[model samples]
Target: MDWREQQPYARKQGESFDVKYTGSCYCGAVKFKASSDPVDAKFCHCTGCQSLHGAPMQWAAIFHKKDILFDEDALDNINFYDSENKQNVRHLPCKISCKQCRSPIADEGRNMMLMFPVAFKIDRRNIPHAFKPTCHIFYGQRVADIKDGMPKFEGHKDHSNKIEE
Candidate 1:
């Protein structure tokens, strides 16, 4: 896999601050831009993430369904995989490349879409702010030596704290 970090770019900041984040696939055949900041960002140590990224963990930024815009043809070329029996997360790989070169571009399920920040073409600094791992699932499958410092919960957090809920 190709790994790279481009120079940081300027971004608007503060509550309500918004900016566009641009990204593309390895061959540049697939390109996209999200018009708003990510609602959530985190790293996953699940087996699916490991197998998809071929790494210890995978970094992602979650955006609302409406914020994402992409080339229709390129979007159709995306390859998807239902990695687990739970069928809660769908992996989207670049279709222009072989398995060895295939890279995850997003994860769609649970009514949300997570874009892999590493594939973005924008400056790293312009990327959305990320939050701590709110929770960790499938802990039993995690590496024994991996330290668990973030909050641990069976699933997503309860939004009862929100007044609207």
Candidate 2:
């Protein structure tokens, strides 16, 4: 299916509120607006994230699918990749070049879309409040030893009180 075909259900809803944040891709080929406060902002240490960002972890912000706004022309160049397991998640990255200079713009994933905060034209300090990293996965592959201060769990945890039948 196409990226537009796989658009999330939440995006169809009428907006109850609105906020704004600006984002762009690596080469500045893309530019866009996020119209809501991210629900869950954190870092992922999974191998896929590590490989994509060329870093030990990837910073991500989760938003309802409908909140993303982009230039119509930029939409054509989005590149999609199904990483690890196609059954579960996919990554959709933009392939546009900046209007003034050729630079790649941005990328989004199945559950989250990440934009480099440093790329925005405004003062970085005025950016939205960011929370502490909630949980870290792939602890085994972490570049350095896990620190002693943070809470560490053996595997994924379900905090919901609802018991499955």
Candidate 3:
């Protein structure tokens, strides 16, 4: 099946999508904008996510790599972390963050990027429903128990079994 069919937006060449969200690194040295709503959003409880985010879980939103754009200066101030020494630098997916403030920007995959919701310019008092996480992934690796009613997956979203509360 075509992946775009499962996504929220599919842009054609020459077509444009307006930026719907903007975010910056802690020191404002790096910035990014997302042109469309996320394809998926979830709370990640994987050990890698916990270690990198220094938190129990990470609230992440997924978007097609092309739909998000970083500032021109972002390249100069960003750092990339690759767990594997995959020689294909051009298409290698890795975590990227601001070098100045050490703030995580996003986790870039082959065709998608997982952006942290906390890094966006959101109004704490009135957060949009779109940014809310729909499920908890990697629940088997979680360090804490959450009683929230959201579905908890033992691994990848639809690829794993949903653990009962």
lDDT per residue for candidate 3 within 40-109, as digits (tens), equals 8999999989998899999999988877877656667867777577332323477777889999888878
Sort order, TM-score high to low: 3, 1, 2
Where does candidate 1 stray beyond 4 Å?
Answer: 1-19, 84-101, 125-127, 130-140, 144-165
Report clash pairs, candidate 2: 11-66, 25-105, 25-106, 27-103, 27-104, 29-97, 29-98, 29-103, 30-105
Better of 2 and 3 by lDDT: 3
Superposition TM-score, candidate 2 onto the true structure: 0.60
> Order of all candidates by lDDT, from best down to worst?
3, 1, 2
Show where candidate 3 strays beyond 4 Å: 1-17, 86-91
Q: Which tens-of-lDDT digit does each residue in 8-46 have in candidate 2? A: 312334644253766665554555666766665555556
Per-residue lDDT of candidate 1, residues 116-141 (tens digit):
88777656655434423444544434
Candidate 3 residue-wise lDDT at 126: 89
Error of 3 at 128 (Å): 1.0
Against the true structure, whose TM-score is highest?
3
Candidate 1 local Cα displacement, residue 69, angstroms: 1.4
Which of candidates 1 and 3 is the stronger one according to TM-score? 3
